[model samples]
Target: MKKLKQIVNEVKDRIAEQTPPAQLTDLLWQLICYPPKMPLRLQQEQFLNQAETFSVTVHDEYFTKKDLQINGFKWGNGKRRVLITHGWGSKAADFTELIAALQENPNLEIITFDAPANGSSDGELSNFLLFVEAAKAIIQKTGAPHVVIGHSFGAMANVVALNDLHITPSLLVSLTPFILLKENFIKSMTTVGVPADAQEAFLQDFERKYSIPASYFNMPDLYKFDDKLNHWLAYDEHDMMLPYSYLKEFLEAHPTIRSRNYDNVGHERIIKSAQVINNVVEEVNKAIAN
Candidate 1:
């Protein structure tokens, strides 16, 4: 894998040298938007097979606002709805343990979906804006949930979608959220040996395509909640995908957002932690009770 990455970087360098600036940026944009298809693991397969499945048709702004069908799962038929969203490259079944734990509550109707290009959804490419649209569609279909829980990139999308839709749930839980979209994209491009000039050009092209600056996606500027909303943020200190410093900086700026940090759960493992699942269930139980 290491050797492969080195070869890929070398090829990227050669492309930068050979291709015109516009073509290079366009290629990079395409590469970044398309997520690799991951095979369903045993656990994910088992969870999906056991759950009730449904499909939602949503218009994706990333694809010129074209309509696409997204797959979703439901675990309960309770009055209080709780929506769960998975991270990038992750399917709804990835929340197997968490959803199983949450299902113990008969009063809660737990729901989740696969974003476009992920899981059983129909697409070859996806972006954060598409995720926001999917969330909105599911929320509209199921009615506003009492609690919305999001993991990693899904967490960021939930924040933006809830704010944009003006649907303030009683509780919002963000687990290991990826907060810096623009900064992280640049860092990823740099790691892949994309030239700094080409990176800048790609950002400009992205802005033109999206009709908004990528900086607008950053959590600090995008996060908004009403007084009635209760927000909970949980993250791991040793998250390898997202540095703790980013969460720290975000918390420091917005001191009032409720947050907690764990020691060894890391990024992905945090989702399967018994402690994390229990806390999330407890929060949801509390919300519905009130």
Candidate 2:
């Protein structure tokens, strides 16, 4: 983490000192796309280490189209399937609590994979496109997931993937998801000290690489909740990483979507809540029962 901070500081200093606007913009674009390499946290490490003791089928695959090697783990033999993933810079083990809750259920078959540049996946950089492609690859391999749950960037990307892939998972759960890429880009720019004049250039370079216009990187455009699908959104009002306020208008407009609010837990911690685990289990059981 210290090294990551130093790298970010050095990038900011370079961005501040660069002579040409184009050069500064290019530097900022690289910073925005690069995820700082971080070792697993203590809990993440313990969870993963413990998971290895179980009878889990693990495989490493080089996704030919994406040019990256991805790792996947499959557990249980039930016919019902659930595909789960974590957010940017987060490993699949972030779902430890939920995984534990559902692991005992003999009726479930759980699938999890680390996205490129996250967890054990092999990549130096990743973006929304990479995330969507990873999800599509997993869905293709596992068949349509009856339930799909994702956190933060993972949640947002799943929305886009499910839509683009024409998949209608019976139950969809999104936790602390950003509504659009523009907000995410703005946050990155502010955090990295991209000068006002260089913002447009940075965005242009990004769009050129990703082929996604800023105007189209939005929640509404990426996902539309079908009436047949059960949609759930869990958010923490105090979440500093992703403000729950982003969903205010969207939630009001979508009356059918079930939402749960937590008071003390912040963005990442919400996943560890016992209440959250219970609620998700109950919801999945209901979906399964019906």
Candidate 3:
């Protein structure tokens, strides 16, 4: 009787652990704590809906962090290729202005697609691993030398992917990457409504290994990163989501990463903000020049 009860309890525990990503998404939406009437423009899609005026479509390809393929179009024929990756819950269209800005330079070939779950892309439940694979596959497909600009979750994934997957690029620009806040993540998750037990288990798995399967801060070779990686992060000091202090470690330790700090740009706004767009262009140009 005692053994049976113990087994039952363990099964219950395991079952409780596997919650839906949507629950976490909802909790995160609630936890946003930002008092903006509407930080995200309500075009319907996760920023992808806003870019419909431009010629874009679903990328039809099998994608993982190491392998990404999509039925997408390229805007320019320039020799220099620049790929833009959107943050979590965002689609390929998020880089509209960034792509336009790069196109003006005449040296850039702009390529972008919806990350797995965000846009018209084929998959669901996108996380670090899938993003990294998609980015790697996209880079390989381009053939030409490239620079990668990743925002938020995408940014963190690219850093690890470049290191782990060996998808080296001419330059890497990261905006609002989230990877070091071990504890605050729980608070962030709580705001999103993740059950207490699920969040705990996720963190336990994340921390059990030196390089958690997670996208952020899992670089076993941070020491090897050179000067070509530039990180552009926008954090409203009062922003409720992330701690800029802990985020600084990625910038400080790596000899190669250069960063820009914005005061009230907040999280979502900075990815496509005019200043961020401009900064990203400048960074890419600098790398191309080098």
Which candidate has the highest TM-score of all?
A: 1
Which runs of model 1 end up more than 4 angstroms from their true locations? 1-20
The candidate with the higher lDDT, 1 or 2, is: 1
Per-residue lDDT of 107-211 in model 1, one digit per residue for the tens?
A: 989999999988789886789989998999998888898899999999999999999898889889999999899887887777777777778889999999889
Alpha-carbon error at 188 in model 3, in Å? 3.8
Error of 3 at 77 (Å): 0.7
**CA lDDT of every candidate:** 0.84, 0.76, 0.57
Candidate 2 all-Cα RMSD = 3.7
Worst 10 residues of 3 by lDDT: 29-38
Q: lDDT by residue for model 2 over 1-290, one digit each (tens)? A: 56456657876787767646677765565566665556778876776665422212212232224367677777677888988878877878778789889987889988888887777877766677778888888788778999999888888889988998888888998887767677778777777776666778778766786677765777766667666668988988788887666777667767788888887777888778899889888888888777
How do all models score by TM-score? 0.91, 0.88, 0.68
Q: Which 10 consecutive positions of candidate 2 have the poorest summed lDDT?
A: 54-63
Clashing pairs in 3: 27-191, 27-192, 27-193, 28-192, 59-71, 60-71, 64-133, 65-132, 65-133, 66-133
Candidate 1 lDDT score at position 106: 98
Better of 2 and 3 by lDDT: 2
What's model 1's lDDT at 251? 83
Q: What TM-score quantifies how close candidate 2 is to the native fold?
A: 0.88
The residue-by-residue lDDT of candidate 3 on 1-290, one tens digit each, is: 34333433443444467645433433332232111121234543343432323222234332232332343446677788777777766766556667777877887777776665556555443445566666666665665346877777677667765676565677777677665534455665554345676666566555453356333443323324666544444455544455666566655676446566777787777766888778777878888887
